[model samples]
Target: MFIPFQPLRTSSLSKKAPTSVGRVVAITGGSGFIGGHLLDALIADDTVSRIYVMDIAPTTRWCEKVTFVYTNLARDVQFEPQQKIDVVYHLAAVSREPGFEWNEYFDINYEGTRRLLKWASKLDIKNIVFTSTGMVFKAGPFHRAPSEVPSADTAYGISKALAEEALSGWQQSKRGRHVAVVRPGAVFGRGCGGNFVNLHRALRLGTFAYIGGPDTVKSCIYVKDLVALMRGAAELKGWHVLHGTYPQAPTIGEICNAFCKVFGWTRVIPTVPLNLALRAAAPLQMLNELGFSNPVHKRRVEKLHYSTDIDGSGLLELNLAPTHSLVEAIQDWRDECAPADPH
Candidate 1:
């Protein structure tokens, strides 16, 4: 149900009220993996008085401070929060998963953001924290800077880049508005079910192998650290874009070895040449095109060889260095999993 926007109640308090008092916050995709963690952080924060979660899906979490609002960004829907929001966290976007069309990505990621900004303008909300992707940059050995031109080749990346442009325009149109864009790399943690989970499963099943070499850089950040940076970004007062990844980018082999060491497995994973692996995966790719669902794909194989190194110096400059290293983060995930492994 679309919650109609309610006007803020007038009081004897001044219009130029300080945020030192508790602030009301709204999140676009609070049901998502990262958004769930962000909600936890806000619940524990003394500076936040209330939270409004707006998404197509209902949040699994229930708290006294949270009110879930059903809203779909992909559709042209009217939505206004019940409370006057001080900050909006835009975390809703479609990932570049299999079978998603180009228009779907554009409509949801680019146009969805435009719709959100329109609502925010009406509420007179000044601060926005958007979660973009490191895929906006080209994959390579060298670290990618935040200011560098976006070299997005996929539909998801292009849509996010366009959304960033729209946010920049919004920030410039107003005098006191602030927008902070965080382009994060592969994020993994307790509740994550992305590449890291697949990697762990592969390692445990003895199906994991090194493609090309052992030194292909894999830029990533723990989800907890990423949300912390997102919270910090909401407090900044200008247009800012930051890359979210470790300063010391970990290699794929190093990641695999870390998994082994943590799990106490002494199995030596084998290495396969890129060309040979591609050739072997070609048949599976053809099968995928023929409507068979399988894990092996040419694109997935190719990505395993490319390095996704990104520069996260901007995070450090903002005093938002991640609290956990790669190993420590892995250990934490292990602990969170407990007797039930990530697989």
Candidate 2:
């Protein structure tokens, strides 16, 4: 018996991931920025046999060479995964926006994941790669290392925690499924559509602002590195939790300085504190979740106060090279905003 709770499908992919060529893998949210990269990476690898992209968004790119399945994880729909997916990359979630109603958060983030796992179990899938966020950590000082336990206070975090717990329970059943949870810090890059986009807007127009205190540090990862981590997890897993962060995380101030140096600017202003931002964001975020086009209160700002970090040693062990350096990424961002070089 399969319980399908959520019925929404989105294709989330990244930029640098190679194409799928020989291996068969099913990725929820394949159309997304990072997920797209996963699809591209898989398709490019001749070792990969086939690639399945499950999501609501139609495959704007590479629709011919790949298997595109339209379905939502938030619902219990009976659709077959592309032929024998040895690896399932679960990247779909609902926290990108702010101020969602409690139930919507549960349905999309929490129950959505539960249904995905159930579907995978039914298929007897072997390896599962879950893309998680650093939001699972409670309000506290930065973590120098990944802990044995998991935690989350808000609906988004709570939902991911519940999913992890469910997966862990399944693992204890001595099932063949190998699950890996990757917690990434502030993920940033070109073409990214989340929190960092706002930062990019600031750089483009010179209105970027920092949240929380100057001491607050946010762990970060280049999207390419994250894709590498996902590939590693796809290859191996044992109820593991790895942080997809660079060994060195940058504080808001440090990030600001990097941008400033790139733009030859003088200063970056500090935004409101996390708590206040949440309060102010709540009303607006809720309004936006009502399906408004641009709501100011985004769900991501809820915990933008303190710095966040997760250990990268596990990812390092998998032999993944870091993609863009802070200097390079920042420079690229600045160049993009400046008037085109009149060459």
Candidate 3:
């Protein structure tokens, strides 16, 4: 019997993770940042016998158990599994924004998902975990709230949302197949040059300055926590979908201040009003719309003024806990990716 997705609510322990012991797993895009971390975790698990990595290229991080299979979802890539894959983590997608063409985005992101689903149908892979972005939710006053509706305001987000729809359709068409779509918000950590990477670099070099009041709330999840979420998703039965973010999202100002304290930077970052910043970046925004690459594009500037507050209640309802703290995770990132100057 197939259970349709419902808004997550408190359920009994019957909804707990099914045993993954002695399961053979496959991860698409396992060469990427989050996938690599997940691969590491899977390798460490004694229960998992073999790990299959399906990507365009091989992962730089080498392990004895991990077998890298060269597969491109864009093409007619053949997926002949040596062993039946009990769980497959679909993490591959074109996440780049602004620079990519519409066709390219849809082809890689949306179509890639379709190809995977087709392969899954052939292999009868019941458990699948797909990584979608929090950007699928439209930006508005609900930034500080849980995003209930699945809508995309950007090309990248639209592509992911469509991929999610494809997954939903696949589940509906079959029985005993479980799918989990995890919408992670601003995932950051070692080896991840996400939104926080630029912020960290600028702050380290004393060039990080906020144009608008840095009070915009942004939800974030550490990569390790994301891995945990993926593990939970793979084990959970039925079709589940939820946002993966910090329970209480911190504001931009709060994030900056925390970093300052951590790095021992005594200087206060400057901030201007939203209107002033928008006025200054208007010309740049116009140029960007005309196909020019503008660093201060209107969309980029708008993100700073708005809130992306995420609700983690869904995760709680599933009884999955994110162990890492934001500051601690950021500190780890700095130590590995960007070390502080001991001046």
Most TM-score-accurate candidate: 1
- Candidate models: Cα lDDT each: 0.84, 0.69, 0.78
How close to the true structure is residue 318 of candidate 3, measured as C-alpha lDDT? 80
Best by lDDT: 1
lDDT of 2 at 228: 83
Model 3 C-alpha lDDT per residue in residues 48-82, reported as the tens digit of each score:
87788889867765554566777899985586866
Model 3 segments more than 4 A misplaced: 1-21, 143-147, 282-296, 338-343
31, model 3: CA deviation in Å? Answer: 0.9
lDDT by residue (tens digit), candidate 2, 1-343: 1112232235422222344445678888887877876776776677777677788785544633366677687797466753567788988877663456777877866788888877877888778898888777764575756664666667777777787787777766766668888888877654575666666556657765556666677778777678887898776757878787776677767776776676677764757766777787788767766876563654456445655655566566667536667767666644544674201
Cα deviation of 230, candidate 2, in Å: 0.6
Q: What shift in Å separates residue 194 of candidate 2 from its native position after superposition?
A: 3.2
Q: Write the per-residue lDDT of candidate 1 for residues 1-343, one digit (tens) a residue.
A: 1123343335312234333457899998998889988988888888788787888887776665667777899776476555578999999989745448889999989999998998888889999999999988767666788888888877888999999999999999999999999999899987788689989999999998999888999889999899999999998989999888887778999899888888988777888999999999999989988999888877688778988887887677789868898888898889877988862
The positional error of residue 287 in candidate 2, measured at the CA in angstroms, is: 9.4
Give candidate 2's TM-score: 0.80
Q: Tell me the deviation in Å of residue 151 in model 2.
A: 2.6
